[model samples]
Target: MATDVRVHLVDDNTPFRDSTAWLLETAGFEVHAYPSGPAFLAEWPSRRRGDGAECVVSDIRMPEMSGLQLQDTLRRQGCNVPLVFVTAHGDVPLAVEAMRKGASNFLEKPFSDDALLDSIRNAVAGARARGDGAVDSEVLAKLSPRERQVLDLVVASKPNKVIADILGISIKTVELHRANMMAKLGVRSLPELMKVALGHG
Candidate 1:
């Protein structure tokens, strides 16, 4: 769906990287495949020049300079390029850490093609909405008190039922408040909402 979008695919495994690149290219994305994080990082500055929807999809574990390190390096340099990590089941803790550090998303190994594509699209969109600015305080002010409460819980990764119980409201009411909060924040999906909640968009 995202025609001509640029995607940087980073992985140590030759086969996986090649296959993923092929898949993304077939889906109309312009992909640059790299064998390691450092390899990708070395070429990132020049590639970031043009204005286009772009994101990095990197394997979390690698022999030299792990994905987390790469993310840290980028953040330290004030680069806000959205990142979507490809991780193994055992690397979930690392993935969660990456999320806390502002990664757009993470996909476990053996993920479906559609899932990866969706994550990349969402990451790029979220980054574009953010655009080196924090979420506007005036937009956040549009939320009602109840909606704000729902938003906080949602950002904490709470489920609707749990949020309802915590707020002394019904599940339906929780959903309603959540919907209103998302609408007020101008977000259409949980990932988008999360980006907003984190004050990035």
Candidate 2:
């Protein structure tokens, strides 16, 4: 089906923005490329509601507002468009912070177009499945920090013992968290748990 999957792309580099937009469009996405985060914010409705924006692909370092700042602003404004951060100067700490803040994905610059497309696809699918982020928040709020950690490891296909070793907890504790996560997410099977862990409703 031809869905209205619009991607809001922001980057200070004009050439890169244009090229990325072209790539996204060629891959069957509708793209609106902006010169900076401020430019996007200027055009985006202040009272934005619902899940209209399919996703965002933005450069992490810009003069007007950094991508991290943009993500924060979007959250504050309740614009729950899924975010993908792309930066030339990406580091592990930066990527980790972005994900910790609920960014859909972070890609280093010079990434393959295929990878970028895959992220866009995943982000859009997750947005549709997530439906405005309220349900996701409600579901996640049910988990403790340790349970959330166990859920992540479970989604990575780790066995309970390996998850215990990684989290420095006992195997019984790992099992408990995994079971709690599954029950909270209302899924009885591992694949269903994985789907919930990935933010699919």
Please name the candidate that would achieve the greatest TM-score relative to the true structure.
Answer: 1
lDDT string for model 1 (15-95, tens) is 999999999999899899999988888888888744538988999999998999999998999888888899999997787
CA lDDT for candidate 1? 0.81
lDDT of each prediction vs. the true structure?
0.81, 0.75
**Roughly what TM-score does model 2 have, to 2 decimal places?**
0.69
Clashes of each: 0, 0
lDDT of 2 at 22: 87
Candidate 2: tens digits of C-alpha lDDT, residues 84-198? 8886753535654666677777777788998788777767655665564534777899999988777755653447865665667899988888888888889999878756765
